[model samples]
Target: MSDSHVTPPPPSPSAGRRRAGTTAALIRAQDTAIPQADRAGSGEPPTPAQAFDALHAYCAPALIRQAYLLTGRHDRARDAVVRAFRLAWQRWPEVAHDRDPAGWVRAATYDCALSPWHRLRLRDRHPDPPSDPADRALQRALLRLPPSYRRTLVLYDGVGLDLPETAAETEASTPATANRLMHAREAVAACLPELADPAALHRGLLRLGSAERSPAPGSRDIRTAGERSIRAWTRCALALTVTVAGATALTLETAPTHYLAPVSPGHAVQGLPVPGSLGPLSRDALKLSTKLRKEAGGGPERLVPQAR
Candidate 1:
C-alpha cells in the first residue's frame, strides 16, 4: 500500500551500466576470496562455502529485489533470499555442479517469497505510506496477478532470465512459459500502459531495481546463517523420517491377521463346473443332456416315441 521502502526512480543508462559493473566486481571479489583449490577451472568443484559465497555474491541482490516485488516487503524479501541460499548451501554438492546455480537459488527464492506461511506475518506488519502513485499502481497491478503469472514475470523480466531459463526455473514447459510471459506482459500493460513497449517495460523494471538497491550479506554471515538453517532442516527431516517409520511399524504390528484354511475338494467344486475345453457347449450336447434327463425321470409315456 505504501512506497516507504520503494526504490527511487530509474538511474540513467550509464549509471545502470556502472551498477552492473559493481555487481560483477562484487562477484569477482567473492570468487577470488575462495581457496585456490576451489577456484574456477581448478578441475574440482568449489567447496560448499566457496560455492555459497559465489552464488550469494552474484544472485542475492537480484533475488532480494525479485522477492520484494513478489511480497511487497523488504524484510520478507531478504528472508526469502537468505532461506533459499541456506538450502543451496545444504545441497551445495548438487548445486555446485548445476549449469545455472544462480537460477536454482532464484527459483527457491520465488517459492519462499510466495509461501502461504508469510501471509499471516504480513498481516501483522504495518503497511508503508504510499510514496509515489505510479509505484503504488505498479505494485498493486503485479500483486493482482495470479501467482504463476507473477512469478513468470518476475523471473523473466525482473530477474533478466531468458524464456527457457524462466521455464526451467518455474518448472513449466517452454511453450507454456512463453504463453505466460505474453499474458503477464499484457496484464501489466493493461494496468501500466507504458509497459506496452518492450523497452519501456524494461526501463520500468530497471527503475524498480534502482529504488531498492540493498547490498547482499557478507560471506561469513551467509555461512553462519546457512549452517544454522541446514542443521535445523536436517533435524526436522530426521525427526519426520523416524516418526513415519515408527508409525508404519506400529500399524503393521497392530494390524489384524487372517489365515484361511484350505477348502476340501468337494466344497471347492460346489460352484460352477469348469468346461472341458473352456468353450461354449454345442446345441447337440445340450439337447442330448435334456433327453437323458427326461428318460431318467420316466414320468410320462409317449405313443409316438414307441412307434419311432
Candidate 2:
C-alpha cells in the first residue's frame, strides 16, 4: 500500500488574529525606533551616512525578525521595518555613539510595543481568545496575568531581552521588573503545552517576514491605500477647518436677516438696503453669526457635527 499522507490543518480564525496582532505589535515597536520628522529630512553627512547604512544592514533583518515574532502580519512588518530604518538614519549621531546599537534598537522596539496604541490593538484581538477548548484555557490563563507581567514575558522569553535590559525598557525598578518577568515566565510556562511549540512559532514568524518582503499577486494596490490614508487624514483636518469657516460665514450672512426679521418699530434695517460692501463690524458680526448657526446644526453636513 502507498504511504498515507497527512496535511497540516489550517489555523483557526482566532488563532490567526492572535498571530497577526502579535506580529503587528512587534513591527510597530521596531518602527518606533525611528522618528517621523527625520524620515523627510534631506541633509546628510558622508561619514555618518556610511555608518548609518552599515548599521541598517545589520539591524534590518534582526528588527524584521523581532517584528515578526511580535506581530504575525506581513504588511505591517514591512512598513514598520522601513519606518525603523528611516528613524535610525535621522538619529545616527546618538544611536551610532551608543555602546551597543543592537541593544538600543531592542529597547526602542520594546517601548514601541508597550505603547498604549499597540496595547489597544492587541487587546482588541485578545491574543488568547476562546475559540477551541485549548485556546479557551490558554485565554483564561492569559487573562489572569497583569499587563506588566505579560510585557515581561514577551520581552524576555519571546525576544530574549535580558532581565536588566528588559527592566530598563519597561521602566519598572530592576527588582520589580525582574519579579514581573519571573511571574510572566511562570504564567507562559504553565500554558505552553496547550499551545503550539516554540520552534513551530519561530518558523511561522520567518514566513511572515518573508511574505512581507514579497507581497502576493494583486496586492500591490497597498501602496495606493497608504497614499490614500495619508490624504484622508490630511483632508479630514482640512475639511474640519473649512467647515468651521463656512459655518461662521453662514451665521454672519444670516445674522443680518435675524436682527432684521424681528426689528422693533423704531429700529430700522440699518446700513445699505442694497447690501453694499460689508463693513468690518458687519463682516465680523456675519462671521460670528455663521459660527453660532453652525454650532446649532444649521450648516451643511460636510462638517463633523458638534454637540449643541
Candidate 3:
C-alpha cells in the first residue's frame, strides 16, 4: 500500500483517527471529476470501466459520505463506495444511457447502508461506547430522524446530493425527497442545543470547502488532473498485480494437467500408508480403527472362525 493509502482502524483507541485519515485519503485518491468524453458517440457505449472513470469524478464523494454517515465507520464507507462502483461497473452499459448514473450509485449505496450485516457492524463498533462531545451531538441529531428521512437527509444535506438526484437514487418521489430534506434539516436544527459552538461548526464547513477546492499541501506541484490520472493508473496496476498473484498461486497448488505415466499401480498398494491417510481421520474413525486393529491382532494362531 502507498503511504497515502490510510489503513483501516484496528479495534482500539486510534480507530476514529484512522477512519478519518482513510476517508480523506480516499477522497484525494479519486481525483473528483467525471467527464463525458467516453460517451457512446460512434457506436456502443463505453464499457463499465470507461463509464466508472467518467462518473466517479462526480459521484464518488457523495457515495463515500453517505456510506460513512449511514455506517458511522470509515472503512465501511470506503467498502460501500467500492461496492457501489462494482455495481455500476456491472450495469454500466444500461446505466451510462440512463438519465442519471449518480442516482444508480446512490440507490445501490443505500442498500449497502441498510443491510443487517452493516447494522451489526455498527453495533459492534459502538457497543457500550462513551462518545466525544462532537460525536454525541452528531448522533443526537441523526437519531432524531426516522430511518428513511435520515437517509434522505444525509444524502442531501450531508453528502451534497440535490433533491431530484437524491430522489432518483433513493427511489423516492420528488415530493418525498423534498419532504425528507426539510424534515432532516429541521431535525438537525432542533438538535443544535447538544451541538457545541454553532459558529465553529459553520467555520468547519467553510474550511472543508476551501480544502476541497485546493490541491492538498505537499502535493501542489503536481497538477490535480495529472495526479488523478496517476492515481487511476496506480489503482488499475495494483488490481492487475493482485489478480496475477492469485492466479500464480492457484496454478502452483493445482495438480499437473499432464501426469507422468502412472508410477506403478502396485506401488500405491505396496506403500504402508499411515493410520491417518485421509487427511487426519476424525476422532471416531481413529478410535474405531484402533479397536478393529486390536481385534485383528489376537495371535494369528488363535482359533479362527474357519467356516464363518
Candidate 4:
C-alpha cells in the first residue's frame, strides 16, 4: 500500500464576517420577537426575560469563544458559557439593568471556567493536542502563563475588549491590567516570533478568536438549569426557615417565668380585720398596712417613711 496525504482547504476570508453578521441578525430577530407588552413606554429596555433572550442570542457564541480561549477546550468552554448564562437568567433583572449586560455575561463566563469546583473534573479530562503548528505553539505558550496573564491576553486581545473594560472584567486595577497585558504580549511574542509586532499579535488573535464556533446552548437547557438553580436555592431557604423556627420554639418552651418576691417577712396581710374587732391603734395600724401593701408587693414591717 502507498502512503497518501490530504491537505485541508484554507479557511474562507469571509467566514468570520459572515458569523458576525449572523450573530447580529440573531440579536435583531430576538428583539423583534419580544412582545410589545414587555417594553416600557418611556423607551426603557424590555423585560428581563426578553432582554436575557436577546443578550443570549447575541453574545453566546462570542462568550463560548472567549471561554474556549481561556480554558483551551471546546466542551469546557460550552459548559462554562451555559452555566454563566443560567446564572444570568436567574439574575435577569439585575443583568438587564446593567449598562453592559454582555460584559457582565463575559465576566460570569470567565469565572465559571476557572471556578475551583471544576478543578478535579478538569484534571480528569486530558486536553487534545492541537494539530496546527501555530495553535500548538500558542496553546503551549498560553498554558505556561499564569491564569491572570492568560485571561488578560484573551480578554484584551482575543476578545477585543478595551483596556478599562478588560480591567473591570478581570477585577484588576487599570495599571495592573495594563502591566499584565504588556507582560503577556511580550511572553506570547517571544514564543511566537511572528506575533512580535503589536498589530500582528492583535490580528492573529482576532483570526484565532473567529475560528471558534461552538453551537450555542439551547434555550431549553438554559431554562432548565435556571429552574433547577432556583429550586435548590428555594429549598435551602425553606430548610433554614424550618430550622430557625424549630430552635425558637424549643427555646421558648424551655424558658423560665419570673415573679416578684415579697418585700418583707410576715408583712403579706393574709386577710382584712372584721369591723369593730380592733381598738383605735389597731385601726390605724390596719390603715398603714393597707397603704404599704398598695405601694409595695407586701406591707413593710415599719410603717414610718424614710426621710429624704
List candidate 1 stretches off by more than 4 Å.
1-29, 35-46, 122-130, 232-308
RMSD in Å for candidate 1, one decimal? 15.2
Alpha carbon lDDT of residue 69, candidate 2? 39
What tens digits encode model 3's per-residue C-alpha lDDT throughout 133-206?
55545655565567687787555545445555567767877776666656565566666643233333333223
Give a tens-digit lDDT track for model 2, residues 1-308.
Answer: 11123222222222322223443543454445344555546744334544544455455666654554344334444445555545444555777777666556655654454345654564334442223454344435544667567556555544555555667767766667666655554565576643354444334333433433423212113334444656787999999999999999999887765344565577666676675675566788889887868663565566656568
lDDT of model number 4: 0.73
Q: In order, what lDDT does every prediction score?
A: 0.70, 0.51, 0.54, 0.73
Query: On residues 77-196, what C-alpha lDDT tens digit does candidate 4 reach at each position?
Result: 899999999988888779877867777888899998876676688552455435667776777777678789989888766666666667788987777777777778779888898987
Regions of model 3 farther than 4 Å from truth: 1-48, 122-132, 159-165, 193-308
- Provide the lowest-lDDT 10-residue window in model 2: 1-10
TM-score for all models, in order of appearance:
0.62, 0.42, 0.44, 0.66
Model 2 regions more than 4 Å off: 1-46, 118-151, 194-308
Model 4 error, position 241 (Å): 1.7
**Could you say which candidate leads in TM-score?**
4
Candidate 3 or 1, higher TM-score: 1
* Greater-lDDT candidate between 2 and 3: 3
lDDT of 2: 0.51
Checking candidate 1 for backbone clashes, the offending pairs are 7-211, 7-212, 8-211
Q: Please report the candidate that would top lDDT against the real structure.
A: 4
Q: How close is candidate 2 to the true structure, as a TM-score?
A: 0.42
